[model samples]
Target chain A: MLNHIWLALIVIGILTAAGRDIHEVSQNSYGNGIPWMLQIESPQTISVYGEAVETSLRVPRRQLQLHFHETAAADAVIPARVNLTHAREGVAVLDVTGDVPQQFKIMAEALGSGETLTARLRHRGSGWEAEFDPVSLVYLKKVTNAAFDIAGVAVQIAIGLIGIMALWLGVMKVAEKAGLITSLARIVRPITVRLFPDVPADHPAVGSMIMNISANMLGLGNAATPFGLKAMEELDELNTKKGVATDSMVTFLALNTSCITLIPATAIAVRAAAGSSDPAIIIGTSFLASLTATIFAVTISKLLARVKMFRWDRSEAE
Target chain B: MEIFRTFVSLLSAIAIPALILFFLVYAAFRRVKVYEVAVEGAKEGFDIAVRIIPYLVLMLVSIAIFRASGAMDVFIAIVRPLTDLVGIPAEVLPMAIMRPLSGSGSLGIMTETMQAYGTDSFIGVLVSTLFGSTETTFYVLAVYFGAVGIRNTRHALPTGLLADFIAFLAAVFFVGVLL
Candidate 1:
């Protein structure tokens, strides 16, 4: 299932990018090779040759409609700096800032110019004609860049976990050695017995699972991860079929993903940052929602385990 | 409600240090060599992290492609009608769909939604509640299963996704009740 889903994402992403690029080409989306007529509104007279002079470039709505073929295009006044080496030939850099069209911004970025777009300018009688580098296959370029960037970021995320993982795992090791984990498991036997019928009640896995779920409930994600991973390692020790997830693992994962919330800290923090009068307003709602999902998650995990395809006996590593 | 909020916040803040202190002190009292044993256990952390590199890279790269290609717009278009039938506001549909796939993507959507609609608005509350309630299913699956080298994750993905779906519905239902 994971193999298929993973393949489908890549296939769909590539196809969609190709389709969009083809559509853009057919529609002349970026007005490739088309020259734009713009009005220069600054620098009363061209005095400093080969020196950049701050200027304002006015793009008329009619010209916008002609170039991009969008009837709804509005007149845009862009702040720019121009370097004119001759009366007829010059270079203008348009600051791609507030209120600019989305297409134009993308074009600027695709052209490798971060926040400014450079265009070749020619003095045409009363106005200037500006020609921008053609942009094509933008979606494909974006998809390629994203894939490469995230691959490295994935390693960074894993490396970043080393310190935290070590800290929590070390603490958990001490707890286990001191016999604290065994007692913790004993305290939670009634619940663990039902949730994980396969694992023994006094097993250390139950202790780690309990700790994980508690950390998750309190929104301690960093702590939750190490404990959760520890639980997986312990549970794996009981697996008869190596390289396959047992029913207990599935149930634990289901519970973890939809664990009940005591405080939705990240949500409240974002709300507060966004200037909400009552940032913690979602606490009750989040708790209720997560509780409902967690109940269903556990039930679903148990039910699905009995199905023929997903039954533990039928699973084998490919 | 205020008291509960304060209590949980304080608990989460103190949880790590307190747990570390308690475990170390208890182990010391029990005559366990704390530093040596902890270092031995910490050694496994590096191996587990390094072992999961392949899984994490492939999983995150796929998700990044889907997001960058703007396939989500098409995906939302296809699912919009089904969601509409269930009384889900079209505005928060992106949040529901993105929540399971990518954490940062959904965070961006949540922030953007709140900025567009006031933070106190119904849509704003619903999106945040949705974000708060569910984990990033794919990420969790990758990291957790990846650590153990579990190749055949039987029933885990489907269960997690279904759980996330239920969480979205519950959020919508509860947020509706709240407003």
Candidate 2:
């Protein structure tokens, strides 16, 4: 019974992690549906063989087996392996083996036409024992291009960004006025007191600016920018002199940038969009990338502010 | 406008009690430290995060539904040629760039893309790999800047966006060469 509790906790922890890894939902596994085949046709064929005429090659369905459909006298029919060549050169899109044998090659009848699987068969009683056609042996060369897929992902993400932005903007206004519009906040901060309450109301502009940044940091960037800019105009009232960017502005920017995320929800969304098996990788990458970017940005901006260069830009505009 | 105004008014009314309730929970939990108090205050903010989860899940499901429903596949079929012209897959195209903008939405599209094409296929692998490595620079920059109150996406955005372009080009070229 020694260390019973500790051992039990360790076992519990292991089980939790395993469950997290291969997250099975009620929906579906990776490839659940591939239609059964009836007939297959080779689009093109080239014979380096000195002989000819045989039965169609035997190729399996799930396992893609290759059997010789060659002539009985030529002895060309059998299970064998072969190399497949693509029509294009410098295009690294083939999964053919280096030195193929009989088993790798399947009968032509195995892969029915109107389907997507096809293989080139070759049997060499010589050196490399691999199949090679002057032209490509199969019809496999990126059925879908890469660039277009990325763009499609980008568009969907854009829509999500917009939706989040709009929602966040609405929420910010609600969170802010939650006290001002009601008698409850008055009970808390004293309703008999004034709306100005000493934090220095610089127009609803500055307050809205702060809220804007807060919302974006909350991952509502689509809706935050305009509100933030307007807040600067609000904060302008506080800078009655030559009109310069204040420490609060820089500090606010720094915090927003460095706002440690609660959930890497957005990156997860991207990973899902990208069709990754493990979309959770976004959690780690997002933390590291966002943290580094935010720290470098906020720190440098603050340091730059100490010098005249930082303040001069805004003041000069004033 | 009336609905908006009423909602705002309602939230204002509720916020005071919410703050108090949060404070009471902190006290009850024996967390009177300033840091804990501050964190407990953030727990109120944390509640908003939790509320957003249903949307995230729904969005992902709908994306799956879209692909399963064949709308996304058809969309990709139309997009494939155009994307092919630029060296991308129609299915992978929307998600590659958009994912950086919003993770949840991109995930939905990603589900669709993977369903249409073999996820292990060269382009699928490349897009998935790149999606992990790349940053949604604009969204991150915008949010971070806003959270802390930086106003100029004017310069920061350009640099970040340019970096994004470079990353995109590099991913395409690398996959073309290697995979």
| Cα-based lDDT at residue B154, candidate 2 | 25
Model 2 agreement with the true structure over B42-121: per-residue lDDT tens digits = 43333333333333333333233332222333345666886789867554667654554445555565566656675656
Which window of 10 residues has the lowest lDDT sum in candidate 1 chain A?
A: A65-74
Restricting to chain A, the TM-score for each candidate equals 0.96, 0.34
For each prediction in turn, the share of the native Cα contacts (below 8 Å between chains A and B) that it retains comes to 0.84, 0.03
Per-prediction TM-score = 0.98, 0.31
For model 1, the stretches where C-alpha displacement exceeds 4 angstroms are: none
Evaluate residue A231 in candidate 1 and report its C-alpha lDDT on the 0 to 100 scale. Answer: 94
User: Worst lDDT window (10 residues) for model 2 chain A?
Assistant: A135-144
Local distance difference test, per candidate? Answer: 0.91, 0.40
Q: Provide the global lDDT of candidate 2 against the true structure.
A: 0.40
**Candidate 1 local distance difference test against the native:** 0.91
| DockQ score of each predicted structure, in the order shown | 0.88, 0.04
Tens-digit lDDT track for model 2 on A120-170?
333333211222222221111111222234345544544454444444333
